[model samples]
Target: MGITHRGTTRRVRAALSAAVVICAVTAAVPAAATAAANATDAVRGPTVAVGGLDVGVERISVATDEGYGAASITPDGRSVVFRSLKDVAGSGGNEVYVHDRSAGRTRTEPIVEGWTPAISGDGRQVAATTPAQGMSTQRIRQHSLDLGILPFGCGRCNEPSLSADGRHLAFGVVDYISHNRRVLVADRDGGYQTIAYLGSGAPARPSISGDGRHVAYQDRAYQKEGVYLWDRTTGTTSGPLEGPDTYASLVQLSDDGGKVVYLSGSDTYVHDVASGTTQRVPDVKGVAIDPTGRHLLYAPHGTGGPSLVLRDLRTGTDKTVSDQPATAEVDSVSADGRDVVFQSAADGIVPGDTNGKPDVFVRRLF
Candidate 1:
């Protein structure tokens, strides 16, 4: 269900302007305990080998102050933006912040008191959800660092994805009465149009192809939700992937528009648009194919908790890039797909419960 309510307002503080100090402490494990925990995790399941590479783990970033919420990266993989709450125990209102790797600096801006920020494919625009004053008036707002705020009207819009050209946007909009959500598309200039409706059922996440002619989304109107594709040029939709289980999430299109990747239940699968063939790429809860279309990075599901997993699609090789137990959920990948950033908890340095306070973390793909 969508978050549909209004309440008190809260302020967000900025991260320290001083240099980022990386301590030697282990994020997921202490040095002495690493060997024993690694052995246990390995025995939980057979280690699948892809491209002669075994999974390795490391910690990239950890939250120190206010909790970070949703995070997104720029196309070039040099910048990241996320939401942060001021007081860990207060109402937890959110504000957007950006981290620039090239400049080695972090900046905070009050974009909106919202969550689920989606950076445009061109890295110029951002679409996010904001709670309305009333229960039935939630809206989605688009912001551009260069152009300021763009006027657009939307109710209960969330999980937004932008096309490669940055001319169009796709998002899930909930219909209040029916309690059903549909995938909708709109021009960057604010022209609203329906893309696909799932009747009484909620439409799954929607992603647009590189050329902006096709869109891939999940639908559950028939039975359980399954990945589906829509040809924008032809104005037709098709799918109901051949599988027993029928739940899917995190739909994403390849940079070249040749393939679609989605989470089918707990496993990640890729489908060839032309051949209609499906294959698995080691199960991961979050998956993204780089803009070059050569590598795939994901957060593999595990009883040891979530960890970032990188896979080379061509070589069929995968590795665990983050050693820390995955703290925050990954939101989006850069257009070039070299870096993955997420929202995590700030525990030790921040003087608050890590689980209650969130922060942003990022890792560069090697």
Candidate 2:
């Protein structure tokens, strides 16, 4: 399951300007640690050699804590934003971090005790779950494209997912009296919230499009249990496109929200929203799709072991991206289908990964 709710008593530093916070945090990190984090020799060349296999992979997270997850990458693959509990000097708790591949630097965001961060395609805006001021309720916070920190007033909202342009934010909010959790899409600048799903049971986390027009979610209600797509243009909800079995989960929509990739039982399938056709992708576990919805990143099963695979939907071709057969799982994929990020417990993915904990790694498909 995704990060549903995270309430913290840590301080919220929303008053500080983004420039001052960034400069202060960047200067606080020790030079030696910064150098060690950016020493990504395994990710520069065409192919990274791992146990005699060629795979261009680099482990990005160097945190000592083992709770790193919910990663998002820019469309250009230049920056990666994720939530980390790494202990920074004089900092309180977990915070959001952005790792720039070109600049070879990682810096913390201004949010305090943030969780489940999602970045926009341009790598400018970021949204995450943070504590409400003076309250234990978890609220959504956004570092908008204009460099201003914005907060949503929903006292019980979490698991924020953003559109590629960062203009729309999708998340789950719970009603206080009815105790029902529904998916909501809100405008970043318009101060409007639209309910995407309002049925009985709890809906799955929503996946939005670049223009915030389409939202894909799964309904857990017994009568209408399947994946669904909500279109804001028509102001209507499409369907619970029947899965193979009763259990269906892990729904992910492309940047255009025209296609959806999800898991049913042990198999993976991609559903075209317009045609209402579902195709079961054999020998792979589909996780995410690129902006165009043509390239899919999955983990092929029935092979030797689990490894990252990038499959082109149009050509029916597959490229194995992970070099070693460790405990790796695909997370997010870049827009151009060239960069992929994942997490694994195995070592040797990069040099100096001696923390003995699961770490996030990026693979370039070039």
Candidate 3:
């Protein structure tokens, strides 16, 4: 799913009115060509290099399968886990599957109808969300890759993320009656605890820094929706960086927690916490930053076809790897920061036909 921008409706209205007058004649051009050209020009800003990066689709996998969902890569970039309803055991719901890049093999494991898989920085633990069966509370389970059992659970938890040290885990949970979401934290051993709560509003996606010292999450408070960062050491929340009225989604703290990357107003921005500076990477959506914080991969929005692009932070150069339109957007990035994976469909959604099913695809960065 795409990131939702609160108060973006008004911004869209304003942009549309301005764009119609500015690009009125150019509107007849194809979106791909326009985007490619505009992106090339926009990337020349001082924060990014003008043109020195390369992007290409390394390989394509899983061409046929329906309902392939969330995915995460291990720290070493040698393996990936994703949710799929392939039902090797004939079960109807989704399960987690692991793809070993080194062995050139794929295996499935029943993680109980889970999605949004997150692997520990050391690649020892996997955290995922498992919906409750039939009116029960949902759960966030931390399963040891070696032990093969859930060692902990967080009720009503979803969108699980892990810190680089694997000591702390963050996820979003809602009140049973009020439906307001609050971010929760717990130890890897299964001790349930509340770290930060946002009352009367929904807080869905939560991401922890690679250093385990900072956390960023989406929250709707007052009459506004925004993304906030919390300092674990200071116990204070940073003011909304995307502005109080604008909603920022897919908030990610860099490996060192020094920078934040988020989708705001249909583009990705990198905010430096220490410098209090922001740099926008124009004409891109659905961004993923590498662990080293030197590279960014994003997909362009509103294109009829799927495409993946990458940008080098040191030098603002960008490139598109694939020409075919992607059915789904890029979801999770690998720990080594070399691979980008997402789900794609063969054909548009058709009833009763599973041939155009959504399958997982991974692209290695070269």
Candidate 4:
């Protein structure tokens, strides 16, 4: 979380812990999609120190270059995918890069400008959104970099998320004028089918379970902008899953799609879809749960900036993974919950983080 000063950028993080958060209702729109247009064409930029940020407790590992952002780890935790302005630099272009932890090598995606990348289950495929020709909207792409085939299929797509197997893609496409949105799902090959439309609900982003059978998203309707789940097999949608009257956003789903982890206000809760039980997480915000719905990675919405916390569902005990002065942007957790990756401007989380910018790091829960 770097804030731009007069001309330079410095790490300054901010977040609010809501004592009571209400739904924005139909007015709740998805966060604006990642902007990838070439904003700087000629001006030269400062050089960033790229490597050697990894040093600390063996469990904590730095995943990308010093200035890299928008990172995601593979299910196996072998590799990481991220976006950075360094690839395009002053030209304002964006470049996607993959870092292989075992090999200590970084490879840039051949694509000209790309952002918002997610990995598949096997750690073999990647799903990202690159700008379309006219650049009105971002299009979805699936591939393995230089190998095999990476196809650019959906145009006007927003925040594309990949299924565990990497076989399916789920994202949003909004109408330019009315801003009406639709959640769409499609196979890797192409041909998208609408999963849910806006009327009773305005979904921000949709996530597919590891099994790729259920789709979960935040329903942003007027009455109650809560969480909703969709079944591809039955072609039906259900939820707002009866817990709090406040707004609910889907944060994590079990591999079996039976348990859902969501945020109702600044508090996190786990909802059992079948048993109709909801467990309020003691105190946390912006959580990510493992596919089993047992392990959770969250940020405490208390005091000042919150540290990333990990909790075990069976034991119900919480451990603070990164207690830093700056605060962390809690991202995604590994399927087994052993690895939790996030972006942070916090120093001492690792050595050599002097770039004064937020970089991605993973904390091994073991």
Q: Which candidate is the best by TM-score?
A: 2
TM-score, model 1 to reference: 0.71
Q: What tens digits encode model 4's per-residue C-alpha lDDT throughout 1-366?
A: 111111121121212121211111111111221122221111111222336333222212233344656666666666667666465644334667655555544555545345467666555566666666674556665555334235444457666666766666677777666667778776644355676666532445677777778777776767646677777666666666534555667776666576777876557888776666678885577556766677777777766754777788779787666777323321366666666666666665655556676666666655
Instruction: Report the C-alpha lDDT of model 2 over 285-336, residue by residue, as the tens digit.
Output: 7777877788888776766854777889888888766756533322277766
Query: Cα RMSDs of all predictions?
Result: 14.1, 8.9, 15.4, 14.1
Please give the lDDT score for candidate 1: 0.55
Count clashing residue pairs per candidate. 7, 1, 4, 0
TM-score to true structure, per model: 0.71, 0.77, 0.73, 0.74
The lowest-lDDT stretch of 10 consecutive residues in candidate 1 is 36-45
Instruction: Write the residue-wise lDDT of candidate 3 on 1-366 in tens digits.
Output: 112222221110101111100000111223432221111100111122225533333222333435675666655666566776565354334666556555554544446555567766655556667666555467765554334445453357677777765677777877777878877665544343455566654645777887777777766676445666766666566656563336666557766677678777767887777777777887677456767666677777766644766667778776553445543322256643566665555343222324666656565555
Poorest 10 consecutive residues of model 2 by lDDT? Answer: 1-10
lDDT of 1 by residue, 1-366 (tens): 110112111222212221211111111223342221112110111233446632221122223444555666656776566666653233234555555555454444435645567665555455666665566455666654434455555557766666655677777878888888877666644354576667654546677765666667777665635666666665666665534365666457765666777776667777676766666765565456665555666776666743666677768777554555443332355555456665444343222334555545555444
Q: What is the lDDT for 360 in model 3?
A: 61
Off by over 4 Å in 1: 1-63, 85-93, 135-137, 201-203, 222-224, 304-306, 327-331, 335-337, 346-357
Question: Over 4 Å off in model 4, which ranges?
Answer: 1-66, 85-93, 112-115, 133-135, 146-149, 200-203, 304-306, 325-331
Clashing pairs in 4: none
